[model samples]
Each structure stands twice: as structure tokens, then as C-alpha cells.
Target chain A: MAKALLLNPTAFEAGLVAAARARALSPAQSAALEAFSKTGLPHRRIEAWKWTDIRANLRDDLSSASAANDVIAPSIFGGLGAFEITIMNGAAEWSGEAPAGVTISCTPQGGPLSELASNHPLANLAFLNTDETIAINVAEGASVEKPLLIRRIAGGGAIHQRVTVKVGACSKVTIIESFDGVGRYFSNSVTEFSIESGASVERLVLQNGSDDGVETALCAVAAETMSKFHQTALLLGARIVRIESRIALGGEDAQADLRSASMLCGMRHADVTSQIDHRAKGCTTRQLHKSALKDKADGVFQGKFLVARGAQKTDARMSVNALLLSDFAEARHKPELEIYADDVECAHGSTVGALDDAALFYIKSRGLDDAAARALLTEAFLGEAFDAMPHPAIERTFRTRIARWLEAGK
Target chain B: MLKIEDLHVAVGGHEILKGLSLEVPAGEVHAVMGPNGSGKSTLSFTLAGREDYEVTAGDVTLEGENLLQLAANERAAKGVFLSFQNPMEIPGVATMNFIRTALNAQRKTRGEEEVSAADFLKLIREKGKLVGLSDEKLKRPFNVGFSGGEKKRMEMLQLALFQPRFVIMDETDSGLDIDALKMVGEVVNSLRAPDRGFLVITHYQRLLDYIKPDRVHILAAGRIVKSGGPELAAELEKSGYDQFIKAA
Candidate 1:
């Protein structure tokens, strides 16, 4: 049993606790749920959760919701010939072969979630909720040509999924994680990534949410010696969507590149928060994030780069730019750097403003109407975020989505 | 032909062009020479229908079409082109793509078929060479990382590509080298036709040396105070705008 709760739990938390009690939860999972109930949902008073009051935004008590058969939609990246794995509403399924050097399966159970990741609130909720973990492994020294896609789908209810991926030494692989939901729902997902020495891994996320749907996608990635990790994401937010990337460079000469972009419309809300820890010598990290918001959409970016003691020659830089397209749109950014090592070079920057009127007029004078001019400038503003992305088809798809969003906004 | 009658424009609650009037007939190139604060840029912007430059009272007709009643882009579609004094550097917009898109937009608005990509590529290459711009420059982002002269060259490139009916060169000669200035002269001279007209706004007679204007008008304060033949440019270059400023 957990100690005396310092705060009163909400009805949602009570319902979740009751649901956990009714299920055959492992001791570790029961403990995780008890801890979660103690904290309930993150509130505005909490420093990290101040800007994003998940508890206040989540109005429904998502304890009892149907987790039965969900209608899965075809993936947007289907034509890319990717190895597809579908996790619909808490159940996992896959079609076709796994291809050479790649393995996919579902585990019977999981012991404990990542200890380092659980230090934050709402961290490992997926692990406590899901009965089994879907695993994907790339064999050693094998370069998988086709992309491995994990498409997670949710309906108008609470759904959770846990995924574990590992890229063996000297192997190269691309993994794309897509989150999509329908109607009002709470979709929670957690993915753990491991990249061994001399291996390279790329993870791309495309999160498209339905109206009034709430989603949270948390990723914990660890890079070993000489391992390279790249993560890119494009998010069109929903009612309230929070995407968190927690990357740790654990061995010497590791490299990590994390980038994301968000384009929100209507009254949608989105948050992209990341934490990168350079825990070893000669590690490098580069991060760039941008958000173009319209209507009454609210966007938030919180990034932090930590250089541990004795982590010399650690080179890291992060920048965030937010464009508020409408008067009612809001963007909040917090970029932090904590370096205990004197020999490290680290920098962070953030900018928020509207579209450049001069640029808009320049294009308009060239014969583009106001809408077309604005859309062109906005798309140009977002050009660099996707330059490093692999696969032209996926890149084109993301650009098409942005163009559609821009058209709808006008 | 471009016609303006008693054009009164205000920017940011302050009147800039107060009952100013001028005219450039078809097949003629007229230069509007004025010192700073004489509303040279305002005149061009107002004619092109920029939103910020509010026209409190005015009648600007381009070939008998009511330009004052149109939007900026609509005016462009009507073959009204104003080359800005200071062009903006739009990063991330590929130069070729933007030009092609703008050209297609205007064509679409006019209910014309869009030019094929291959045709556009050849056309842009030809214009790009005429403006002394390279293929590498065409591959870059629009005006991004370009010098002042290069930006003017870009303006000339569009001027050639669009082939507007009425052209307003707002200080297109300001930041150009000898070769670039000569290129501008060549481009304008090449595009000169009987059915088209030009309004060349500048503070110097050096550019006029390259492309001789049929008429020169001295704008003081907000209105043209003096109008004469080509010799007026050389005369004003020697006498300065002090005489016109005092008279207005």
C-alpha cells in the first residue's frame, strides 16, 4: 500500500484505481497504479505541469471505457512498403512477413517500467495499463531497407500501448510511430528504444488526432558508444496532446538528434517537451522544434539539455521557433541548459512571433493572393525542420498535410 | 497607360500623398524625381494598392481600369507591377518554385492555362540570364542570402517573367553596380512596347542616363510641382529638389 496521500484523488483517479483492482495486475503494476493514484493527474500548481493542466483539461472519468475490437484505419505511410504493426485500442496485431533481420512479437507480461523515466509524472502510465508489450528487434549488423511502422489507433475511449524496440550493434533501421484517434478519447503510449554501439536508428512520429481527443506519447531512448539516434515528429494537435522525448546519451562519442514540429488549428492544444542528458564524454546533441498555430490553438515547448559532471567535449544546441498565425493563438516556450562540466559547449534559443508582413507582401506583389502568400511563407518557415528526414515519400506526406492545414485555416 | 487624379493617401493616420496627380501615357517612360519624404514610395505603393497606404481620396486608373478598387494581388493580375525599393528575403521558399507559383497564380486568376514546368524552367532560365542571375541563384531560396544588387536583379527577373502592362520601378537603381544598372537599362529597354507604360521613381539621374525617360516630373511634398521633357532630369540633378520643395 502507498503511504498517506498528501492530496485528494479525483473521481477519475478513484475510478482508475478501482479498475486496476478489478484486473489481474502484477505486483509491480499494482504498485505503479497506487503511485499514480496518489499523484492523480498533473495539475496547474505543479511547476512542470503549470502550463499544461492535464487534470483540468481531462474532464471525463476515463476509468471504464470499451477496450474491445477497434476499427483500424489504413496508414498514411502504407505505400512506402513499410513493415506494419498495428496496436488498436490496447490490442496488438501485425500482418505479412517481418522481413529479413527484423523480428516482431508480443510479450506475455512486463516487470517494471523504466526507473529513470518514472521520475516524472504521467511517465509510465502505459506500462501500468497495458497487459503486454509489443517488441521489435533488428538483428546485429543488418541494415533493414524498408521502414518499420507501428500504427496505434484509438476510439472514443481510454487506450494504452507499450512498445519496446532495439537496434543491435552495427545495424541501421528506421522506425515510424504513428498515433491516431477518433472522437473524444485518452490515448496513452510509451516506447522504449535501445541503440547499441556503431548502430544507427531513426524514429519518426506522425501524430494526427481527432477532434476533442487527448493523447500522450512518451519515448525513452538510450544511445550507447558510437551509436546515432535521430527522432523527428510532425504533430497536428487535438483537444490536448502532449509528446515527450526523453533521450540519454550513455556512452562515449554518442550522437543524438531530436527534432519536432507542430501545426495546430481550431481550439486544439499541443505540447512538445524534451529532455536530453549528456551523461558521457564527447557526446553531441542537436535539437530544433517549431510550432505554427492558428485559430485559438495553444502550443507549448519545454526543452532541457543537461551536461553531467566530467562529461567533457559535450556539444549540444537547441532552438525553438513558434509562429502565432491568429490573434487568439498562444505559444509558451521554456528552454533550459544545466552544464556542470566547464569544457562543454551548449546553447539554447527560442523565438515567437507572427508571419513576416514584408515577406507576405513581397510574395503578394509577385501575384500570389493573400492566402497563398501566407501559406507559402509559413511553409518556407517550416522548411528546415524536415531537411534531415529520410524517405522522400514520408516527407512529402507531411508537407501535404501542412498544406492542407494551411488551406483549411484560410 | 496609367492615370492618377488627385490621389490623396494617408499612412498611419498621417497624410503622405495629398492630392498628388500624374500621368504616364502609353509608349512613354516617365520619371518621378523627389527627395526624401516627398512620397515617391507612397505613390508607387498606393498605385499598387498596398493595404497600409490608405487612399483617403483618389482615382487611379490603369488603362481605364479602376486600380483603386482592387486588392494588391488583383492589381498585379491586372498587369500592375511595383518593384519594391527594399525587397524582402523569404527564406525556405525555393526561388524557382516561388516564381513559378506566382506566375501560375496570376494566370489562374486570369482564367488562363498554367505554363508547363518545362516551359517555365526555360522561361526562367532566359530571364535569369537577362538579369545576370545564374542557375545556382535560381535554385536558392527566394532572395535569401542574396546581396542588395542580387535582390534588384531578382526584381528584374520577375519583371521580365510577368511582363506587366504598367511598371513602377521604385528606386530599382538605388543599390546597383555599373553592370547591374546597365542590365536594368537593357531589361527595361528590351521590354519597351507601344501598348505598355513605365513609371520610374528615383532620386538620381544616373539611371536615367542608361534608359532616357520621355518625360520627367518633379514631385515635392506630396504632388508633382513641375513636369518637363528629358532635360528636366539633368536640370534637377544640378539644381537639386530645394527649388521644388520651396515651391510646393
Candidate 2:
């Protein structure tokens, strides 16, 4: 077996290979496992995983336990009147009336891996371990009145899951994917979104994890002509977490808006990374990321926009700003732009610094105490990304989460 | 309503206010005229309870309460307002919302009832118009993209809204036009009452033309060198601060 042939592997890697060998693997799963075995697990040595070293995090052998039967709490989005689908550990379950014009199904295994999934090591790991892939399909020319919520809950084990969303032409849908968990566990998830021509998808990912949890979620998106993909992610770090996205604007005149905020405190860490590929003409992309770190926490953001040779008139701009609240807190950012088209406009910027003392003193002099002033300033710094949320309730929900983090810090 | 006794302030271990004593009785407007680096701003900041300005010695009291024992926000709650010389441009902080929050926070700290949102909106719009700021400008972030005159006008707007007991205008007229200076005088004159006091710090007498002062003091070399009537401002403006600098 490849497990024995592989050179000195870590305990976690060996445990993963042993678990795969014990199961009746499908052909696709075996292919993914073989591909994953070549690189073992992403670590500091890998250029992409330099800031987030997964191998170093999972040094000990972790058993592949079944999903814990913990009592599931109501999701924070329960008031949105949306259709809910729950994924506990690696298992998927849903019992409710699906949203109008939306059909859901499950397959024993997903189809061949996409270009992005094939290259990402964490995505391959998830694909190999997940037995059922939940697929949500929106009908053509349908405007769904309700949102679709995917609640992922994990507990006590190494769990992996896969989900795919397909939006038909001229349809509109909002999807909220939330990650919540308890106790010690490792969660690796891969999600794919295929938006047809003229379709619109608003994706919101909220992750709040336990202190002992390690999670990696990678989402790949393929946007067609005139399609719109707007995504916002709020990542509250766990022991170690990385949420990444790979977007390909393959059709002309497509647009994408990606914004993310990470508020990490204590000893936790979070990394938000994305790579947007502009392969069509006249496509526009705007990306912004903000992070506020406190205590001894660490935050990282890595973003790149690539405009292809034929992607003329592509307009893309990316900005990242981090506010460090402590002397020991750290923020690392890398924003890059690679353009081969002469007519394209692409730019990127990054900044990392502490909160403005003048602003804080101004606020304090206006009547807010020290803690209240700090909280107000920090919220304003991170609240800019969520200013454009179409739904006021959702925006308030995100702001409430930020407030809770600030409160906890105080 | 405000009194300072032998106040000594140091910034970065360098004394700026050396035994500077002053007093502003209730319903009176006092002007402190000084050249650059003459401890004018240091006095305002020290009285406002700024952390960095070390008070090596002295006492400051507002309404017979020991103001030096409180924090900046607490001092604010105690009705001490220092209109900053250079207002900060705080991005992402809505101007109206922040002013309302500050008003409510001060009220709450003083064990008073908070204002309703509707009432706050109405009050801000009224004051914003008085300060020559449109509703669009008030909707933007606090002082963001605002001109120097507009920022000072916003400060006047706050002054009108808060109506604190003690007011310290630290170089409030440095960047204002004649019209804005008139607006500042109007706001201060309108807020004047039997229990309120004003300390207007300025370099020129132009702003004094609109809001006449009961007394004017020339500050130089970290101390008050001379005192006179409002005519002192006109006199110093004509002769400049050269004589006072030499005398110090």
C-alpha cells in the first residue's frame, strides 16, 4: 500500500491512510487518496501553506471517530425563514420543505475533481473521506424568495465533508454556510459553486469554532457570462483555521465581490486566502479583507488576482488592512496582481498597524470609556466590509458577532 | 465655574505649563492669547485629563469638584468639553451616530436619561444646518473628507448639542473663515448661561470681534504674562507677540 511506501509520515498522516485502507474505497476516492498521498499534508515548507502549517498543528495520531450525537442548537440564521440543511461531522441530514424552485439530492460520491479541487491538498483530503456529497440545484430563471442555510456542526474527531451548489441560468439564490463545533476535532471541507449565465449567488460563510478545533474549508467557484458571485466570510479563529476560495471568471462581463473579516483573540489563529482568475473579457472584481487581532493571536490574508492574456478590460482591485490590538499580536498579509492583458486595470494594497491613538482619544474624550472606545474603534475598522450586506438582519447578525468578540476581549 | 491653581504640566518629561494659574467665573468668557509653543494647548489638554500630559503639580476644579481625579470620559461627563485644535478624521464612524452616542454616553454616565433616536436625528439636523453642514455631510464618517472649516463647524455642532457646563476652545478659530467664526460665536453665545463658563484660546482678535471676552490674558513661556480687557486682543494683534516673548 502507498501508506507503507511513503517515507516517514506523521502520526496524523498515517492515521488518515490507515482509515482509508480500512474502508471500501470508490475508484474516485482512491484516486483522490493517491493524489493526497503524494504531498501528505500541507506544512510550513509549502509556499501556499507557509503561514498556516496544518501538519504542525496535527502532530499526534488522531482517531477517525464517528459523528458525536450532541444535541444540535438552533442556528443563528433560524430567524431568516430559510430552508436549513444540517451536516454533523461527515454526515448530512435535512428534513424540511425545500425552498421554491430548488431541488436537493445526494450522491454516494461526487463526479471527477475540478481543476481547483485537484490542486488543493485539503480539498482532496475532504473528497477522499466524504461518502455523501450534498448537491443543491436551483431551477432556471427562478428567483427564490428564501435563503438556503447549511449548518455544519462537528465534535471530537477528524471529519471531512463535501457540498456542491448549482445555480441555473437567470436564477438568484442566497446561501449561508455556518460552521460551529465543540471539543477537539479536525474538519476539512470542500464546497463548489457552478453559476450559469446571468445567475446570481450570494454566499455567506460564518465560522465559530472551539478552542481545540482545527478546520480548513476551501470553496471553488465557476462563474459564467453575466453571472454575479458575491461572497462575505466572517472567520472567528479556532486553534488553527484557514478558509480559502478559488474563483474563475470564465465568461465575459461576469462580476465578483469578495469581502472577509477575521476577528481573532487569545492564542487562536486564522488565515483567509483567495485566488481569483480572470479568464474572460470585461470582467470586474473587487476584494477587501480586514482583520483585528488581540492578545497573542495571529491573523493572515493572502490574495492574488490574475488577468489572462485575452481577458482585456478586466478591472480588479484588492485591499487588505489589519489592526493589531496588542504588542504580541501579529498580522501578515500578501496581496498580489499578475496581469498579462495590456488593457486591464489591476491593483492591490496591504497595510498592518495598531489602532489610531488619536482616534481612540478623540472617542474617549467624547464620552466612551477606554474599553468602550476601543470596542467602537475596532468594530468600525472591521465593520466596513459588512456595510454592503443586502439584508439588514444578516448585517446586524454579523455585527453582533463582532460585538461579542469585542466584548470577550474586554 | 473653572479654576486652576499653580498647574504644572509636562509632556515627554519637558515642562510646558509652569505654575500657570487662571480662573473663569460662571457666565464669563476668558480669552488666552499666546504665540506658538506657549503652553496654550498643553493647558487645555491637561484640564481635559489627557493621559500623556503629566501633571507634576497643581489642582484643577470644575464646579468645586476635583477634575484632576477623573479620566477623560469621566471629566467629559462632569461637563468639561475641550474642542480639539485639530479634529480627527475617524473613518467608518458615522458622524451623526457617533455624536449621538457620545451625547447619550455622557448623559448616561451622569445618571441622566438618554435621548431618543428620533429626537437625536432632529437635533443633529437642526444643529448641522446651523453649522452649515448638509445632511449628506452628517451622514458620512466622522470628519472624513471634511474641510478644515467644516471640521470646526462640526465641533461647533457638538458644542451646541452637548451644552456642557465648562467649554475650552483650543485654537478653534485657527482654520475657520469669517462666517465660521461668526457661527462659533453664535453657538457659544447661545449656550451661555448663569452656570456655564467659556475659555476661548486664540492667537488673533478676529474671532473675538463676534464673541466679546470679559478678560484676555497673554500667555508666554508657560505662564500668563499679562491680563487686560478685550482690547488686549486688538492690541496684541497689532503689535504681535514679540514684546511678550521678550518679557517672558
- Top candidate by DockQ: 1
lDDT of 1 by residue, B137-233 (tens): 9999889999999999999999999999999999999989999999999999999999899999999999999989999999888999999999999
Clashing pairs in 1: none
TM-score of 2: 0.97
| Tens digits of per-residue lDDT for model 2, A1-410 | 34444577799888898888778888877877887787888999999999999999997776754455565567878888878898888788889779889999888777866777778988888888878889889999989978899999987689899999899999999999999877778989999999999999999999988788899999999999999999999999899999999999999999999999999988989999999999999999999999999989999999999999999999999999999999999999989888899998888889999888778888888898999998889999999999969878889889888988899762
**Residue lDDT tens for model 1, A1-410:** 44426366666666556666677877777777767767777778987778878888675686555543445567878888888888777788888889799988888555467645666556556667788898888899989999998888887677778888888999999999999887667888888888899899989999988767788888988889999999889999888899998888998999999888899989988999888889999999999999998899999999999999988999999999999999999999999999999999899999999998777777787789998888888887776788746778888877877787788752
Candidate 1 CAPRI classification by DockQ:
high
TM-score of each: 0.97, 0.97
Q: Considering just chain B, what TM-score does every model have?
A: 0.99, 0.98
How much does candidate 1 score in TM-score?
0.97
Please give the lDDT score at residue A127 for candidate 1.
65
lDDT of 2 at A118: 75
Per-chain TM-score (chain B), model 2: 0.98
Model 1 chain A scores worst on lDDT over the 10 consecutive residues at: A63-72
